[model samples]
Target: MPASAPAQPIKLVIWDLDDTFWRGTLSEGSVEALAENLQLVRDTAARGLVHTIVSKNDFAPAEARLRELGIWELFVFARISWQPKGPIIKELLSQMQLRAANALFLDDNPANRAEAQFYNPELRVADPTELPQLVPLLRASGQPDPTLARLAQYKLLERQQQARTQYDDNLAFLRDAQVQVEFREGPAAVLPDLGRLEELINRSNQLNFTKRRVTLPELEASLRDPTRRWGTVRVHDRFGDYGLVGIYCLNEAENRLEQLVFSCRILHLGIEQFTYAHLGFPVLAVQGDVATELNQTEKPDWITVQAASAATETPAVVATPTGQQLRVLLKGGCDLGQLTPFLQAFDLDVAEEFNFNNEHQIPVHLEHTLLLRATREWPAAEQQRLAAALPFLGREAFDTRLWEPGYDVLVYSPLMDYTQPLYCERATGRRVPFGAYQDITAEPPAALAARYAQRRFQGMSEGFLQRFAREFEHEGPISPAEFQQNLQWLRAQVPAHVPIFLLSGAEIDVPGSGETGARQRHELMNQALAEFVASAENCFLLDVRAFVQTPADVTNNLRHYHRRHYRALAQQLAQAIGAWQGQGLGHSPWADLKARAVGLLPAKLRGLLGR
Candidate 1:
């Protein structure tokens, strides 16, 4: 096979690590890290292009090396091993749900590239020497995706694929997936996504049934035309949300489909056939070589139409008095501070109560259930004495807006309980949750102080570290039983009428993250949290595991997620809140869009803009 220009835009870039992604072979010696390749991966990834490895190397060493280089998390569905490159690349593309024609394979060896092309005839092949010419084109390929939402979606697909392999029966996997589709009809619903509609109509091929392309002006006109019933299809499953995957234009006047197209991302999900059946199996003039054959009688039993929530469909019955905003106090780790703006987009007045640096220059986290209990139960003298004794806990740490009656609703995350280790005061036998995984008292004071210093943490001086070690006994993270007990106590503390929504942790393994067994820890905590929510009144669980399934879904650790996921989380939180209130919360699409755009800005710029 000879190399030719891709028929479609390159959506994926497959890299051969040795002498290609980096300078030298890993099996032989330390490879010189390629600065250009590193930056290219970052730049191209931000623009929605997916990258993966198809190198013929040992998996462990190659993974460790990639981790050392700080680019291990960027790639998904990595196929690194001493395997034939040709067959591996072909299978890799299949698993990634990508077409070979829309993928570029880069290898330094001409023979490797030739072999890959032989297996995948349409795959674009390039030598490392061509990167100087190819970098610009690759960078310009995808639309601006500052949050790497596209990358996240593909990661979701990768997870789904991996899980699918576990089941020998495909139908069983689909059934277990719990696939759901939501259809949006009418001009008001479909017009806002005019750009996406146009793109799918023109760019999609494998599932483009009518093959009727339209310009933006024509699309806008057709959407308004009463004769055409246009609808957009959104799909989600146990895996994650696949937003607006398919579009259909039904000619009601003739009972024929003018347009029925879907992104290949939803291929094999039976969405096309599902959508056709949902639309009463409209007469469709079949286009050339569609991946799926549509039939009139069979609708996929695996996929069910997700019913629009009563709150979302109708004006929300305000929980407070008329014209008053619902006061929501969000309490959690500082990372959850990202959800405030998105939550505020709904008809709610949001107040944040996150951990902050105290007078002793140490960060104090107060969201722990025990701390919440101490705020009211502990005597003033005792509180002051402990506040003075422990640098990690300040006088203000015991104070929280949670006890204040000013707020009507509470959005709380008990992640600190899930991640932090507890230390007991030898004198009082009172336990206080602090750092994660490590016992502070067990570490040498000098080493601990130096580690804290590197993080620019103050007040963890050698003197304080020594004093702390002498006085406090290390107790590991809270057990699931104790966690449930605390949850019960907290519920009793808050008023019965007030709704408490808890944000659960992501139970995904983050590779290269030093936090060992974090996913297992989260799974344990999440189960306890779910059990508590099931029995507790007015308590809800904003489950993140549905969307945050892979290592790539999180950053650095399991507790923190990519910025875009925060928006999805906020949306989930709002819906749960609305359902509790017995009405849908009002939303500002403009505000949501603005937040998304702001999320794309550089961190410094976002900070300067006060986002």
Candidate 2:
């Protein structure tokens, strides 16, 4: 039986790797790569269609085979484990931030396709034998993406999702992400992206608040109309750039939004809410149930306006550079590493000093305020002895770039103080920051060592774990009063002229997350942070609670958030930095374009280019 035509154009192609993508099963023997299938993926991907995998094979070998076939990186959110096809496909779509209707699953097994359709009633599924009939339609699905920019954006989202899992706290992840948005208006700007505007207006459903559809000619005319205010939204974060992901048109005469639409790619980043707020919450008569609800009062502070829109009350002044980039030192968890790319988009020289696995294979976090004080006040002998004795604190544990004088500004997150527990040394009464919540000393050495071994951490043997338990006592998280005092000390330590931009913690409860009373803890700490920032000179707070409010806003815990939030956080950081400097940071359009273009290159070529 022939598969019926889908109601929506296919944006994603889910493959069954065993007999569908290749000739045979990898678990049994070597499988032959299908040339036609390979060509179809390459061609459709270039046309902005995404591809993924759903296979009942070991992830490692299957991924290795795909890489060998030179198409591994082309797919996002690949589910290769031995899981039920139906549930996995449903979850995969949710993770990819895509809808079932916009995805097509191709499998060799009739049972597998039926299971997928059963799980997702709107999902379109077909047998692998239908490729000959569906090839042209698949190739013709998406618009031309010469740079494979859409594929690259999905890859960026893939990297972000991978990173989000590492964090236990969703708000913490978002605060470190550093998301930014640029709104471009006028015919000179919005007209060039006419095709994207048309697609977003007509095809977008979930985020298409107004449900307004317009043809190319109609859109072109609307852009030129004096009665309408039109704009395009471009976003970039620590992950990568999402170029022109949204469009908005307001009927100025009636103070209503005529057309408000965005690609599902930018979902959960609060782009739509931010855009509505940016437009002063114009009267938008929503046609149907939309993914986001627009409110008149709340404006998402996480998202910063990079380019001034016509609606901006006070336009930022783009700074004239002095032939040199402002040196910025970003210090936080390794998760903040996402902010580097987005921060570099501005006229700033970014330097990252994040947590890393030391030579002992123990992950060392150096961003703690207690550790910062130790770096300055602790005797050299004490520092060296602790660094050598403790696997958690390697030789470089006490070392930091904070003392360096070259950097002009400091972008810091004091989340370690909010999350990490303090361990006091028995001999010298010196306090050290390590781990979070759980008392590692209480756990059996065998169990602790086994956990460490699973993580491939060396030097954390049973004997060493026993010794660590004996020598150090867990002191719990830092007290708010002590936290404030430390902040004062840090302010005194840094040069007064250099402004310190601090990121505050989110205070939302994540129900299933085992961290009981974490929200209350964050609330207490947030208050302490706010008090410090209010009184302290040259200190500003980037409060994440402004946007990361609901449980749905986070992932596993209160600290980690969806990828889009990171882009919004980056923009807020840039805007705050600009305010401190009395001018907006110089944006590199070519740098952003180059970043997107780099994704379009072939995987081999991208690796060769060292991207």
Candidate 3:
């Protein structure tokens, strides 16, 4: 059947920039990344796909910046506003005279995509990162695809796939949206991803698929599983190149196609039905001895969210939230994501610091909980430095004035002074061991404090702290052998159940010298790390000496900001929290951490409740 084009002829292919183009925190990023993004948009338009923008941004200032870049005219229409995007997108579609199916909607945020899908189930949804591959499907080239039939279900095509009108999923949404399977098998090789599968998977998910994502290990592991046969297909039709576009994973015992997915970008090219008789799989269900069953898609595990309404709990007799003065410092750093979500979780007012002294202690609406991050991990400098002042005498394109560094400071000692602090290392995704305190014999608090005093004299001073800090740079006062001895001692002391992470980061002065010493330094850094941890009795030591020794990738000096790989570390923290919950760390262990933190701390503190 010939396709029906929109009345407007789609002279422009408009897109939402934030979550659509790439997964990014709307609050911050570098000018360079933003420039590359705009260039990508223009390039897409240049490739015969006219592009436009209908995003939610501050109008005058947003357009002014785009104009400065000389690509403002690329977008024929922009619904820039603070209102909900559903109406905005609908308005654009109506103004452009386009039907839902003909109109392709791209957004990074799942809520926005769902809203558009709810309004018009037939429209195609995608992540902006998938744009380069998806343009073909909308163009005059690609063939008809049935994977799209499932998308209609995701947006309410049928009872099996539609969201309940009232909304009853968080975990289900994640599992369904995030369970990605690729068919990478070659053609004539008897695997699913022969020719057309890769295209379907590329555009399968809009919310979770990161750009340039690769799960090489998982793909390789499937080969060792005799029960499963996995394959990927690379295809290119007469029109253009279709990079590795399909994958297939099947379970021989179950006689089930464990995984069969393709990129949606190349759909409608008549390659959709390769899964049918062409691939030797039936599309319909089996009834007799399961021999006639169709291939089954992979099922994903979903997270379970325990329900608890704040309104149902009895009101505590504590004082209500009150305006109180507090000191805040806006230390420079890279914020891969905004700090607002965390702050809002605690329900507090925040503002930038104007001065560092008591004068800066502006009044904040004090809540029952208030925790300030005095020292977050970040780079030592801002991300964007003036290109001209790069003082490097060596041959280089430009100099970076700022770098994000690792800040290994801990949150205010968690209610207990542990002999060996339980730190979660960003590297290795495991616990590590550090320090010299070797015993926790159920001793009284007084006895523990006394024991701590003796160690404090040796561990807390300038000599010890300096030496500890220098361990990363390989100038620790403790010798290599002594460090190993300490590690053995620590290993003997720690509890087997705990994951101990002992970390010693480094900082190197990258002088005018070239990048020649990096390898040797890497080896030294690795050795120092191995010795540091190997010496500990029961702790895992991460030789982040080399890792943190270099300045941060972000501009912030604090490691918590997007500097020192903040998001990656945050994920580790999240996992640790998940692990902690799994280990039964709280009353509800699974109760919402943010909610419980705000509600339980006051009771746990006995008398220090704040309002």
Judge candidate 1 against the unseen true structure and give its global Cα lDDT, from 0 to 1: 0.82
RMSD of each: 17.5, 23.9, 26.5
Encode model 3's per-residue lDDT on 1-611: one tens digit a residue: 12334343333355675555434534465232355556655554432344556676677765765677786765655667777776776766654434565566677777777887776666666666566565444554222211222122112212222232234764444344322222323212221111123233333442112222223223334544677766653444222234344455566676565555545433322233444333455233322221112333422233121111111111111222345211111221113123322322322222321111111221111100001110112122311121111111111211221112221111111101111222222332222222222322223435544554564322233333333333322111233333333333333333332333333223343443333333344344334444333222223332222224454432333122232333233323333322322221122233234433543354446234322
Give the worst 10-residue stretch by lDDT in candidate 2: 309-318
Top candidate, metric lDDT: 1
For candidate 2, lDDT tens digit of each residue in 370-416?
99999999999999998888888899988898987878888888988
User: What's each prediction's TM-score?
Assistant: 0.53, 0.50, 0.24
Question: What TM-score number comes out for model 3?
Answer: 0.24
**lDDT per residue, candidate 1, 5-50, as tens digits?**
4457999999999999999989998899999999999988876799
By TM-score, how accurate is candidate 1?
0.53
RMSD of 1: 17.5
Number of the top TM-score candidate: 1
Clashing pairs in 1: 316-584
Worst 10 residues of 1 by lDDT: 309-318
Better of 2 and 3 by TM-score: 2
